[model samples]
Target: MLLRMPGVYRPQGDTRLLCAAFHDANLPPGGTVLDIGTGTGAVALTAARAGAASVTAVDIARRAVVTARANAWLSGLNVEVRQGDALTIAAGRRFDIVLANPPYVPSVVDVDARGPARAWEGGCDGRAVLDRLCAAARDLLTPGGTLLMVHSALCGTEESLIALRGLGLKAAVVSRAREPFGPVMRGRADALVRAGLLEPGDIDEELVVIRADRAITDH
Candidate 1:
């Protein structure tokens, strides 16, 4: 088990799904990895154990940063855990691999969510954070590098794929699973329906792992 702070996003179906897909992709060994929105640093640790030469984890929450750092130390792994906006922290850096389990639950409250809700409440159609990541992914990865991101299909897997492709990254859905509404999703089901993201009574949600690779052939 890993250390978990009160407000950090916990590892669940989506987390395991991303890790599994990433492993199956067989990313090149001894490469650098960047884990954005890394709550407990689970993905970062996974990358390290997968033979990545280096792993950098970033989270916006202070508690999450502490939790991830503690977990990394406890696991006796070397992970550079940073507390800041992922984009800001990763500026001018490129990695051979990128992993993310971004918040995608549609939220009715507002686009700018806070506290633990910040962990899962995505604005409106639930792409607030996801969209930014897709836009930045191309710049964050080295040529031939792969980005593995997991999120609810309710947030629009096609949108993510399209966004990445628009940035010249080759993108596709590499893995998918149907998961029941978790606490946050269940709590915001009505909001999602109102936002036209879900139909009435849609209890089961589809989670997808999107893979986008910067083509090595590109200049």
Candidate 2:
């Protein structure tokens, strides 16, 4: 069956990449999967199609949840999309596979509260959202379960790796792509320049896709 996801979904490109990467990792069939920041339910639906028995998708935006559910129904995929922050979801809820394409757009400028919550906004240095997600992922994963995340290279990839390792999660770079800076970063730079956080000349930036996995250990 063809998969249908929202084109406007933030980090849509990375979301698609991570979904394909997880499938390629040979995750056990019929395992429960969690897709954090599941905009459009792409990764969650992909996991379901790849033989996950249950897929739970969570997002901070209610509209994202609604859109994800609609996409799931349209694609005939069974996925549970919930409206809640990833950090505050049900405690003790564990999954065999946890996947995320978080916001990695670092900015010195303040974000607009009314703006669409792009899944990839990393604060200041671009690791804000990623830090929260990685920390929470430690508790959300089951023994022997795996966590897959896609992030940008400019967002201090080394720091992110160290953070995950500090959390006792084994990390690796599974895939990467070099792309021009996204609008978030560009806009952030503009805002920062106006606010004196950055110079007008410091606008060009590069993006990379870094995938990390958390290895589950047996007690």
Candidate 3:
């Protein structure tokens, strides 16, 4: 079991989807890994258990860092948990595999707002963090590297594919699962419907796992 602190994102369907996708990923022996927005280090621990050479998990929440670190210790997995912005922490480093399960729930809440909501609130369009991660994927990855990311279809899976392909990477959705709205999405259902992002009475969201790969010949 993983240890999650208050305010840290709980390991839900999206997290499970990402973990399952990671299992099917082409992780070379001794490949290095970076897990962005890792909450309880669940995905990071999975990589480590699979024998990744190194696993570094980053989250903006201090509580998450603590929780992840503790979980790593509890599980006897070697994961370097860091508390900082994902982009900033990933700067100057490249990994063979990048795993991301960032916030994708659209909301009027400020992306910078503090508190538990930060774990799932993804700004007005739900693309705030998604866009940033896509834009930075190339820089964070080594040539031939692959990124496995999970988010709600409400966040525009097509947009993510376009962004990665535009950056010269091969991108596609590799997994998907529909799930009933959780508390957060249930609360935003009306607003999303009013904004035309969702149909009236819609109470389910599709979670998708996208895989993007850098061509080995690129560099």
Q: What overall lDDT goes with each candidate model? A: 0.88, 0.71, 0.91
Among all candidates shown, the one with the greatest lDDT: 3
Highest-scoring model, TM-score: 3
Off by over 4 Å in 1: 110-112
Better of 1 and 2 by lDDT: 1
TM-score of model 2 (CA atoms)? 0.82
lDDT (tens digit, per residue) of candidate 1 on 100-150 = 888888777554587777788777778999999999998999989999999
Residue 44, candidate 1: alpha-carbon lDDT? 89
- TM-score (all chains, Cα) for each model: 0.95, 0.82, 0.97
Error of 2 at 159 (Å): 1.3
Model 2 Cα lDDT, one tens digit per residue, 114-152: 336465556777778887876776687777777788876
Candidate 3 lDDT, tens digit per residue, 1-219?
A: 677777888898999999999999968999999999999899999999999999999998889999999999999888999988989988999999999999888985334557777788888889989999999999899999999999999889999999999999999999999988998888768888887799998879999999999999888
Q: Give the root-mean-square deviation of each candidate in angstroms.
A: 1.4, 3.6, 1.3
Sorted on TM-score, best first, the list reads 3, 1, 2
